[model samples]
Target chain A: EAGVAQSPRYKIIEKRQSVAFWCNPISGHATLYWYQQILGQGPKLLIQFQNNGVVDDSQLPKDRFSAERLKGVDSTLKIQPAKLEDSAVYLCASSSRQSSSGNTIYFGEGSWLTVV
Target chain B: QKEVEQDPGPLSVPEGAIVSLNCTYSNSAFQYFMWYRQYSRKGPELLMYTYSSGNKEDGRFTAQVDKSSKYISLFIRDSQPSDSATYLCAMRVQGGSEKLVFGKGMKLTVNP
Candidate 1:
């Protein structure tokens, strides 16, 4: 019954500094995702993990961003040398296997980051 | 062109009024359509999900998908102040790769 859980609801760092966000998905959920939502914009997927394995990360900026789900239950997204453009909300979401009803992804409160 | 396009509106309307929001997608491969509502500083929550086409109604919210026109719409009736939030339209292809392409989100304010 518990939804996805995230930590450090808010964060602020200077440009070029590093920041990380953690997420613990719903119990028994097998798929996890990390998304970045800039102010006034929709959420943009950064990466996806399917039980410890990456499913997609094509949109992720490898030069500065990285994420991992080691055990498949929890995930962490990191950004190094953060830029002002990187200021956004990091949202973690999870979902069960695809079914006839379709995959319904549930999101956490998100970790807000502001790079000064 | 972007795969999905939605007007970013900070629309304000009186309470109890009917509201309509829409999005257009360029990808014909997208088989699943969804609507998510997000409040300030919060994550997005799923509001509606539809497969393929046609219309699906839930309470005061209705979602319609027109694949031929590559357009999708969400209609809210008797809106309340609580319904004020940013609405996003998302879509994805069926089967492998659960990547969802999202719109720019439309912000709505219902004044009582």
Candidate 2:
């Protein structure tokens, strides 16, 4: 089976510009997640989606960031007026809801964003 | 204090050696613990996961969690050069929203 798929493996934008990343989760996985990983730091959850609805986005910077999973399959995360600090790797992951036990989650290769 | 503490060591070890990694957490409510391996320019992949406090083994990897002490560990036996990567520890608090609290990862290199 194929793993998660993400577009634009790498991106570079100006600090004030807007950027968006796309993710297509595994076929049938009901849980989708977006994470930001800075250099020298672990991946931090930016948002999570259960099907087409959001399950959690407490850490998301609502002021400049927004995300959505439409039709319960594909997801998009956007950052407007991006900041230099927003430069990091954006990772997407998926897991089946059957895993109430919190089993393994598969991740995509990630989109590396660099803001100058 | 950060919820999780980990020593970010760029530790180098000879091949075939035993590799041990650990993380300490501050949240007593965290019940599920996991370890992930990330290669350069790649996303993290789950290596092992443990619930409650005990050890779970798969092939050369072993994961251990101690709920009483809020400590977790991952051990790799007969390590190979392919095992060189960053290891991350993550935990989620029980009875609340399932969000993972992660520690700064430890980078390991297995010399050939």
Candidate 3:
């Protein structure tokens, strides 16, 4: 089985510019997530999708960030008017099941963004 | 205080030695614990998951959770050079949408 896949492993953008990252999760996985990891920090949950519907996005910066999981297989996370603090690694992950227990989450290689 | 606290160590150790990594959290509602290993420029891969405070072992890795103290630990036995990576501890509260709360990862380097 293939692992989660992400596009454009590295991205460089200037402040106030818009950027987007794409993710293709493992087949049969029902839970997909997008996380932002700043340098020297852990990945922070930006959004989560259960199939084609939203699960949780409470921590997302809605004023500048948005994400969607179209057709339940692939996802895209976008940030408009990016801030300098938005320069971080964007990570995508997926899990085969949705229970509060069991299933392991698999992650992609991440898309690193550098906003100048 | 941050929800999670971990020493971001560039922890260096000789090969074949045992390694211990740990993290603490402030939330008492968190019921599920997890440990992830991340390589350079890569997303983290789940290494262990434990619930309720106990010990679980797989191969050369062991994970321990102590809910009473709000602390967790990961131990690597017979560490190898390939074991070098950043380790992150994450937790989630019991129900609802279980988005993980993670700690700043600890970087480990196993020397040859």
Candidate 4:
């Protein structure tokens, strides 16, 4: 089975510019997530999608960030007027099941964004 | 106080040495614990997962969880250069959306 897939592997943008990243989770996986990992920090949850609906996005910066999982298969995370602090690795992950535990979360290589 | 605390180490060790990594959490509701290893510029992969408290070993890796103290540990036996990467500890409550709360990853380098 194929793992989660993401692109583009790296991105460079200037402050106030807009950027977007795409993710394709493993087939049959119902849970998809987007996380932001600043340098020297662990990945922080930005948003989560269960099927085609939103599950949790309380931590998402709604003023600048937005994400959508269309058709419950692929996802896209976008950031407008990107801040310098938004320069981080954008990770996409998916899980086969939606229990509190047991299922493994598989991640992509991540999209590295550098905002100047 | 943070929900989870991990010593962010650029710890260097020689190959064949025993490596121990750990994390502590403040949330008592977190009943599921997991460890993930990430290579530079890459995303993390699950190394192990433990429910409640106890020890779970997979090959050369061992994970220990202590709910009473809210502490968790990961041990790599006979470390290898391939083991060089960042190790992250994550946990979540049993219900609701069950999103994971992660700690600052600890960087480990196993020398040849």
Candidate 5:
């Protein structure tokens, strides 16, 4: 089975510029998530979607970051006026809500962003 | 204090040696525990997962959870160069939310 798919494996933008990342989760998975991993740190969740609805986004930077999972199969995360601190890897992951082990999430290769 | 705490180690060891990684969590509500391995410039991949408190083993990897102490550990046996990567421990509250709280991953290198 194919795993989660993400695009624009690498990206670089100047400070104050905008950037976006896309993700296509595994087939039939009902939950999708976006996380940010700064260099030398563990992944920090930015948002989570269960189908077309958001499950959680408390940690997201509301002023600069936003995400959407329209139609529930794919997702996009965007950051506007990107800052140097926003440089990190954007990871997309999915899990089957129907499975008993729903906590086992699978991640994509991630989109790397470097804001200069 | 952070919900989860893990030592960020860039530990290096000879091949075939045994390796141990650990994390401590402050939330007693966390019921699901997991370990993820990430290579350079790549996203994290699930390595092991356990529910509640107990021990689970897969191949050369073993995961142990001690709820009373709020500690979790991962042991790799006969470690190989391929095992070199950053390991992260994560956990979440059962029946609450699916959001996972992660630690500051520990980096390991197995030199041949």
Candidate 6:
């Protein structure tokens, strides 16, 4: 079985430019998530999707950030007018609704973003 | 105070030495505790998971949860240079939401 897949493993953009990252979760996983991990810090949840609908996005910067998971399978996270602080790794993860360990999530290699 | 607190250690230890990492959480609702290892420029991968308070061991890794003190620990036995990485502790509420609350993560380096 294949793990989660993400596109554009590394990205570099200007502070005001826009950037997008794509993710394709595991075939049967129903829960999808996007997280931002800055150097020296743990990942912070950006958005979460259950199937095609969003379950949580409380920490997402609504003004400059937008995400979508269409058809309950693939996801895309976008950052417009990116800030220098936006430079970090965008991690995509997925998990079965319930497992022996109560939803063990698997993460992709992540998209590393650098904003100048 | 942060919901989860951890010592962001850049701890260096020799190979074959025992390594211990810990975290304390303020939320009592978290029922599932986990540890994840992340290499530089890579995403985190799960190392251990435990529900409630107890110890769960997998090979060289051991995870312990103490709900009474709202504390958790991860122990690596006979550490190897390959074990060098950032370790993060995460927890979530049982039953409904799957969102994970993460700590700042601690960096460990084992000399060969």
lDDT of 3 by residue, B1-112 (tens): 9999999998999999999999999999998899999998778988999987899999999999998999999999999999999999999987677688999999999999
lDDT per residue (tens digit) for residues B4-51 in model 5: 999999899999999999999999999999999999878889899999
Candidate 3 vs candidate 4: the lDDT winner is 4
Each candidate structure's TM-score, on Cα atoms with residue i matched to residue i, is 0.98, 0.96, 0.95, 0.97, 0.98, 0.98
List model 1 lDDT by residue over A16-61, tens digit each.
Answer: 9999999999999999999999998888999999999999999999
Q: Which has the better TM-score: candidate 1, or candidate 4?
A: 1
DockQ of each: 0.84, 0.74, 0.79, 0.78, 0.78, 0.81
Tell me the deviation in Å of residue B23 in model 1.
0.2
> Which pairs clash (backbone N, Cα, C closer than 3 Å) in model 6?
none
Best by DockQ: 1
Docking class of 5: medium
Cα-based RMSD of the predictions, in order?
0.9, 1.3, 1.5, 1.3, 0.9, 0.9
C-alpha lDDT score of every prediction, in listed order:
0.95, 0.92, 0.92, 0.93, 0.94, 0.94
Q: Please provide, for model 4 over A1-116, each residue's C-alpha lDDT reduced to its tens digit, 9 standing for 90 to 100.
A: 89899999999999999999999999999999998999999889999999999999999999999999989999999999899999999999998775454777889999999999
Chain B TM-score, all predictions listed: 0.99, 0.97, 0.98, 0.98, 0.99, 0.98
Candidate 2 residues lying further than 4 Å off, grouped into runs, are none
lDDT of 2 by residue, A40-94 (tens): 9999999989889888998999999999998999999999989999999999999
Model 6 Cα lDDT, one tens digit per residue, B1-112: 9999999998999999999999999999999999999998778999999999999999999999999999999999999999999999999998766889999999999999
**Model 6, residue B52: displacement in angstroms?**
0.5
Q: Which ten residues in a row have the lowest lDDT in candidate 5 chain A?
A: A95-104
Which parts of model 3 are misplaced by more than 4 Å? A98-101
Candidate 3's C-alpha lDDT?
Answer: 0.92
